[model samples]
Every structure is written in structure tokens, then in C-alpha cells.
Target: MVNKKPSSQPYNLLPEAAQTLLALMHAQGEVARLSEREQLFSSLLDSVNAVLWAFDWESRQVLYVSPAYERIFGRPAGLLLADFNEWRDSIYPDDLDYAERSLAEVLVKGAVEDREYRIIAADGKIRWLSDKCFINQQTDNNQRVIIVGMAEDITEKKQLEGELQRLATTDALTQSSNRRHFFDCAHHAFATARLDQAPLTFLLLDIDDFKQINDTYGHQEGDYVLQRIADTGKAVLRRGDLFGRIGGEEFAAVFPGCTPQIAQQIAERLQREIQRLSFSHEHQTFGVTVSQGLTGITDADESLDSLFARADAAMYQAKRQGKNQIVSG
Candidate 1:
């Protein structure tokens, strides 16, 4: 019997050659499809503006980061993939704790959709981000935990919100708190003072003969006078005190934790500041005076409205007796 060596060429192995060739062809086709799929995904990731990332929870490793990561974060994606701490380092110092803690919550909650935070970019500019993250549980029966997230820049949205808030709460002409915002704040302070039995003072001021000034100097000069008086009030008020423009020529201030004596002194200083502000129009320089009504918290005072009423009466009394003076109610 002749013992022949097995043929090295696959085709010579007649019995199994067909199966082997078919398997090889199928594998080649699958490889090509996989390559095309990967390229398609890479293109899609790069086209977007949000940063997409995947992390391995068990090893604390960054498994993948999309091209948008570098563009949005202003840092190299390679650094983040190499060390997860690079992502953590980019978070704003004040938001670092909340960012980390909220991310960890995804493990229990399965998803976190409303995570918004601030980050310091490579250029030393602050950018706001709305980051959403979720746990990937479809692989291997969740034996290994993975986190997937997309972070989008929302700086413009945040800025718009801030501007809208300022517009709503601020007086455009004088740059002071508007009437509504002032009353809201004063009401809150009044409640707090009543609860704590703390001292609080309220001052109501009106420009002396403001209508006459407008008639004599024109509305533009009247506006200038209003701005200067507002500036004086802002300068003279102590920190934690609230000042606002409540009417055309009327401003109100709330001095939290102030005694009657201290509030009187503050009002006097504000009057002096206004007197020093001299405005020239049509070859004549004129100064302004503010008639102020000062009132302090009393056991009989039930609400901020009561304080305002007494202050209002005292201010009218100052006007009648002779303007440019402070009357305590």
C-alpha cells in the first residue's frame, strides 16, 4: 500500500475544498461590510457638533470618543482616551463636584438627561454644556457596565436666558431694579425681618419738583438727572441693601438690618451725593435735591405695604413743609 502525503493546496483536498473556499468567501464579504459600516459611523460622528463618548466602568477607561470631542472641548481626543481624568479636568472648578456626582448617578438611574454644567475651554473661555448620559445594558447581559454620553454646547442659550431675566427684572432707563422686582424682594425681606425680629428700614425718595425740571430742562436732561440720582443711591447704599426705581421720579430703598439712626445717616449721604452732581444745560448749571421719607420696622407694622404707606405719608409731609429733607415716620 502506498502512503501519499496530504496535498498542501486547498483545491487538492477535494472532499473539504468546496466548504473551505465558501467559508473564506463569506468571511471576506463580512469583513468588507464591517469596514464600510465603521467608515459610515465615523463620518456621521464627525459631522455632528456634539461630543459623543463611551467609557468602560469596570476599568475606568475611555473606550471611544468621537471627533466632535476635540472640536467642542478644545482638547485632543487622544488625551481623553488615554486618561479619563482629562475629561474631569476640563470641568469648571465650581461644577466639578456636581458633574462627577451626577455622572455617577447614571449607574442607578440608567439615564441622566438634564445634566447641564459649565466647562473651561482650552482658550480660557467658559462654555456651557448640556450633557446626557446613559448606561449601555444590551451587551453580555450587562455583566460589564458601560457609559455612553453626548455633550452639546449650550452657551448661547444660557446667555439668552440671562439677558431675558435682566430685561424682566431691571429698569431700562436707570439700570435699577424694576418696580415689580423691588416689591417682590422687599416683601421677602419684610417677611424675614418679621420672623427673625430683626430691624429693617425703608426709604421712599422723590425728586423735588421733577415735573418742573422736565418742563424747564426738557425730557433728555430730566433723564440725565434721574440717572445721576440712581447712581448716587447705588453708591451710598450699603452692601445687602436693595434700591429700585418704583416710579417716574420716585426711588425706593430697603435697608436690611439697619437701625433708624443708621438709615438716616445713609439717606443724608445720598442727598449730599446728589447735591454734588451738577448738570449743565443751555448755559446754566443746576443741582438736584431728593425728598426722602424714612421708616423703621415697628411691632404695629404688619406688612411691607404698611411700611410703604407710612413712608409715602412722610414723604408728602416733607414736600409740604419744604422739599429737600428727610422725614422719619
Candidate 2:
């Protein structure tokens, strides 16, 4: 009975306490690993150049959006996530209807891949996007319908395609339609006129003694004259009229739904405009004139070639008559 029984020190833990402590340590380690994995996934999304998004269709709420949303759209991701209308408002006014309709189509079609449209960014710059979307047909545990999509910035690609089209269809020196493109359009117009039984006029014009000017003032000055004449033609022609430089010193025009009398009036206007243009080379000042041949579509005409032949012959007639006049065929 020393009565030292159960010393004042706390008692040691039982076997059950040790097991609980080890279990708690294991859970903490797992949580740390999960957090690191989550961070890695988010970093990957931020590096991408396209916007990836997930939406809860039933709730009309944005579920998630990648970091690229801010860069391409020039708007904050938080704003878009808070209000889906932020996206609808960014669409170009003219394309808004099509963009919304096409997006809705994804619900029925399962996926949409060819959805290209324009958007006005926050910075007031216009951008083009090739947005593709897919619908997950199955509902989640919460009965939420989700729509997933990716939008890529294709503005540079669109611009390159436009430039290539211009190079293919336009003359570099005069900035007018080239011969090949002009004939292509003219052929289409001729067929339409024939089918609709509409009146169409064709005019062929040649600069008077253009070679003499080129030889006198050199090719550079000759190019300047050609450019000015082309500009005048563009300015005088009706909106629907097609004008082009068809040869070195020859240009042509097609007037759809125009009678020969009205076409003559337009030709006279073009003539006056050209006459008003004066050029100087060295110490000499001079002016140039044009000889034109006019023809109209006829019941017997079979193709554009017939119209071309008549107009060419008539143009030569103008050349023979005076060199500065119009001849009708």
C-alpha cells in the first residue's frame, strides 16, 4: 500500500486509438494528392488557344469555361459564367440569328461542326470563330442536360482566304476584275438574261492610240492612264453593272436589264468622264479618248461568244469611223 497506484501521469493510448490515428493520416495524404491533380488539370486548360465550355441546358447556367474564353472574346470569364447572355450579345448582329439557330440544332443533331460566325469582341474588333458543339444525350445524377462546345479563333484564316480570292479575281495594276473573272461573271449574266428573256447590253471599249502614248511616255505613265480610266469606269457604272479590263488597252462592260438607249446614255457619261481626264508627260500635256462598240442580246443569240463577236466588230467600226466615237451593232 504505498498508494502510488495509478500515477498522476496520463495513461497510454489503447490499440484502437493507434489505428484511428493512422487512418486519419492516410486521408490527409489522399486529399493533398487530389488537390495537386486538380491544379494540373486547370493549368492544362489555360494553355490552350481555344475556348472550351460546358453548360447546364436545363438550368440555363454556365457550368465551366476554360481560360481561353477571356483571350479570344476579350471579355472576362467570370462575367460569361455569371450570365450566358454575355455570349449571345457578343455575336455579330447580322449573324446572331443563324448562330443561335445553328447552336440549337445541336440538340437534335447531337453535334455541329461547321458552325462559323462572326463576333464583336470587347475591344470593338471583329473576330471570326469556327465553333463546334455537342450534346450529351444522357442526363446526369441531378437530371441536368449538358452542352459542351469549343470555339476557335479563325479570323486570320478568314482574312487569308479573302486576300487569296481578291488575287484570283482581280487585276493587280488596275484593281478591276481580270479577264477570266469578268468573262465568268459575264457568261452567268448572259445566261440569266436569256433564260428570263430580259434585255442586256454589252459594250467593248478600246483606248485610241494607246500604244503611241505608251511609247511616248513610257510604260509607267501608260499604267497610270489605265488606272485612271478603270477608276472612271467604276465610278460611272450602275451598281449592278459589271466592268472589267479585258485586254492590254481594252475594257468591257455588261449591263443587265438595260435597254440599248439607256446603255448609250451611260456610255456617253463614261465618255465625258474620260474626256475630262488630262495627263502630262515631260513638258507636253495631252488627253486620250476611247472608241466603243455596243451590242444587245437577241432572240437568235446562242451564247456569250456571239455577243462578244458583235461587240468586237462594232468596236473596230468605231475605230474605223473616227477613233473617238461609239458604234452600235
Candidate 3:
């Protein structure tokens, strides 16, 4: 049996001119292939909305960044190319630790990481970004560990979520906390007050002759009156006070670390503030007042309902005693 191997010819075996032409053609073909590959990579990255970036972990230097970085981060690519600190400095101080911890996780554990954080852009505006990144271990003689990552601008999505949360927890009529949110805050305040044995005051107010006002002035005017009452009450309340419209024409306020006497004084001032609001109907101008009931947290055993009921009774007492006054329970 005869064994035959593949034939081979060296370029030197050819004429000099022919060899040069062959080498030139081969080089041209290689160039064309590289050009095609570069075009494909550019097209793929250009179509993606996210920022693509790579860096050497050891040197802490950025090797490459896609064009989207300029568009999304609002900074020139040359800035990131020159120094990675420029990108690091753009992170919001509050979120800097969070971003660093994510990077540490990837570096130490050799894992992919996804994190959301805020950055101050070149435009002096805050932006939210969702970053997904991974570290590629050393795979070459240079022992270079590369970090590749992508980040997408999520500022608009975060804003939308915040709006939804506000709508869920806020009263539409007066822009005050809604019933559920009020109780949520009140419960937390109650727990804290109990733990510290601090005096927590609660105030409940009802619009005087609210139903009659609605019947006489129409719902729109009634709404305006309620709005005015809420605005006035909020203005008179202190900074730490929590005010909420727990019911129609009825509102509740909680003052942590306040005495019943001081709460009553604040309520009286709120009543006066309400009386100052001028409302005109047809040709008549009139002002309305609120009847307030105030109470302080007596003990840990008292539930929110019981304490609120006491305040409600005092408010009705105010209604019976002259219609517009502040009464302490």
C-alpha cells in the first residue's frame, strides 16, 4: 500500500512578478474580509439602543465604547476614552457606593451583575441607568482581564413609576395624603411614639355645614371650598405634621412629639386660616370655617380607631357648641 500526503508549493517557487501579484491579491482579499466584518459590527452596535463598553480591569482604563455612550450619557466619547474616572465621577454620590459594590461583586466572584443607579449627566440633569456587566477572565499571554458592559437609560421609566406611586398614595382633590397612606404613616408614627413614649397628637376636622354648602353652591364650589380648607390646614400645620383627607369633607392630621394643647392652638390657627379664604358665588362673597377635634396619645393600648373616635366626638362637640371652633379631648 502506498501512502500519499497533500502536495505543497512555496510562493518562492513562482516567478517574482507572479509571486508579488499573488501576495497583493491575497492581501486585498484579506482587507475586504476585514472591512466587511467591521461594517457588520458597526451596524449591529448602531442598531442597539444601549451603550456598549469594554475596559481593562487591571489598568482601570476604557478600551472601547460604542457611539451610543455619546448619545445616552451626553458626553463626548473621547472623554471616556481618555480616562475612566470621568465616567466614575458622573455617578451620583448617593448611588456611588451601590455602583462600586456591584463592580466588586463581579470582580471578586467572577459573575455577571445587573444594577440600577443614578448619574449626573453632562447636561447637569440626573439620569437613571440599568447596567448589566460581566468580567472576562484572562485568556491571553498578556493576562489582561476585560470587563464588558452595557447600560440603558431608564430615567423616563423611573419617573413614570414615581408618578404612579404618587397617584396611588395621594388624594386627587386636595393633593394631600389619601386615607390608606395616612393610616400607613400613622401606624408607623404610632409604633415609634409607643417605643419612645413620646406624646403624639391627632387632629380631626370637618367642614362646618359642608353638606349645606354643597347643596347651595353646587359641587364645583363645594370642591373649591374643600380645596381651600385643605390648603389652609396644610399651611398652618408644622413641618413634621402629616395631613390627609381620610374622608369627604373630613380630614385627619397627626403631629408626632406634640402636646394636645399645642395641637389645639395649631387647629385654632387653621380655623382662622380657613376663615380668611374668600369665595365668591354669583355676586356674594363669603368665607367658611372648620371645626377641629384634638387628642394626644394616652397609652400604647389605645388603638388608632379608638383615639380617632375620641377626636371625632370632640369635633361633633365643636359642631354642637357654635359650629366652628377647636375643641380638645
Least well predicted 10-residue stretch by lDDT in candidate 1: 6-15
lDDT of each: 0.93, 0.93, 0.88
The better candidate by lDDT, 2 or 3, is 2
Clash pairs, model 3 backbone:
none
TM-score list, all predictions: 0.87, 0.90, 0.87
- Residue 32 lDDT, candidate 2, scale 0-100: 92
lDDT of 1 by residue, 173-257 (tens): 9999999999999999999999999999999999999998899999999999999899889989999999999999999999999
Candidate 1 Cα misplacement greater than 4 A, ranges = 1-36, 137-142
TM-score of candidate 2 against the unseen true structure: 0.90
- Report the Cα lDDT for candidate 1: 0.93
In candidate 2, what residue range of length 10 has the lowest lDDT sum? 6-15
Evaluated at residue 169, the lDDT of candidate 3 is: 99
